[model samples]
Target: MSIVAFDLSRRLVAEALGTAILVATVVGSGIMADRLSEDAAVSLLGNTLPTGAILVVLITILGPISGAHFNPAVTLVFALRRDIEVNAALAYIAAQVAGGIAGTFLAHAMFDLPILQLSATARTGTGQWIAEAVAAFGLVFAILAGLRFRPDATPWLVGLYITAAYWFTASTSFANPAVAIARAFSNTFAGIRPVDLPGFIAAELFGALLAVAFAGWLLAEPKPPTTFKAAE
Candidate 1:
């Protein structure tokens, strides 16, 4: 169906469900990885692979329905670009956050863990903040650039970028505000402390704004002639 044909309710459902599944995969994989491996590196590899793969799958499947943002940072960027209405962006953010919470609970249920708990994983400090900023910048830049020049490849590009960022960045590229918030509820390998969220969220927003600014300049259309003659 065309975008216009899908009503707001349908789009909101799609966003919520997609974000829920994405977060579930992230949290679930982290739990499973931790259980299955003693080596920290190996557990991280397991978590990274599944999270990236699920992102590719989810974006490819849900993109046509809801644009498959699944992240408040992404939704905010689109709202700033006027690609979506402000109210719709707010609704989307709400759905994403709620879905993320549900996903964490679902993962906990599947893993037979506590359904509600605060993470004590302290992922803060200047190095971590800088890493988050850099990670968010690269993620948004790749997305905007891919959409401009290679729209069909955007899902894969994003997945690959996140997979790489998981290894390269200190924060493991939590680049999403919704995901960061939800992760705070779980005290697992993938969790971030609730207190550490502001820095990561701020870094993410700053990076997204930078990407938007850069994309506007890089993708602007050529100017038309200013000295046009009057028609006869």
Candidate 2:
């Protein structure tokens, strides 16, 4: 039905569960892809497809419940837009972060790797930071434009955009802060160094805010012209 049909608790649960599964998909697929391929490109393709596919599925199924935010940057955008209440937005962010960490652990457990580990994969430099910003800008723009133009197609739009962004972006488009934070716990192909986290998160947030500003002007509907009635 509608997003408002669900209560805050249910919405939060969906957000948590959806984010958990999303992080699991990213981490688990990266591990599997790395194991299966010697070619970095092949492994990345392997990593990208499952993530794109799962987004389509997860957003389709969960969009009605929590609007399928799954990302703190996205939640913040909505909070800024006043689409969701401030307190609820905070709760949603907390749930997403918690779920994302849990998802990292879940992937580790499934792969029989150590659950508690810090990522040492160094993802830094100006190009990488700029790439993360661009990636997040594309993501938030995609979501907003999709909602404005073709609400029914948002799931596919997001999935396909991310699929392409993963290849194009130097950082492979870890556009979600929660996802970035979670990935920092796993030293895998999808992972980023814990030390690299602040830059990525900051870039992601800045990009998301930019999208909101741009979309607010770009996607907004024109107001009806004011008419003065003839003097009676």
In order, the Cα lDDT scores of the candidates are: 0.89, 0.93
Alpha-carbon RMSD to native, per candidate: 2.8, 1.9
Candidate 2: misplaced stretches above 4 Å?
Answer: 225-232
* Best-performing candidate as measured by lDDT: 2
> Candidate 2 lDDT, tens digit per residue, 121-210?
999999999999999999999999988889899999999999999999999999999999999999988889999999999999999999
lDDT of 1 by residue, 51-124 (tens): 99988998888888888889888888788878888999899999999999999999999999999989999999
Q: Over 4 Å off in model 1, which ranges?
A: 1-4, 223-232
Model 2's TM-score against the true structure: 0.95
Candidate 2's C-alpha lDDT?
Answer: 0.93
- Give every collision pair in model 2: none
| Global lDDT of model 1 | 0.89
Reference-based TM-score of each model: 0.94, 0.95
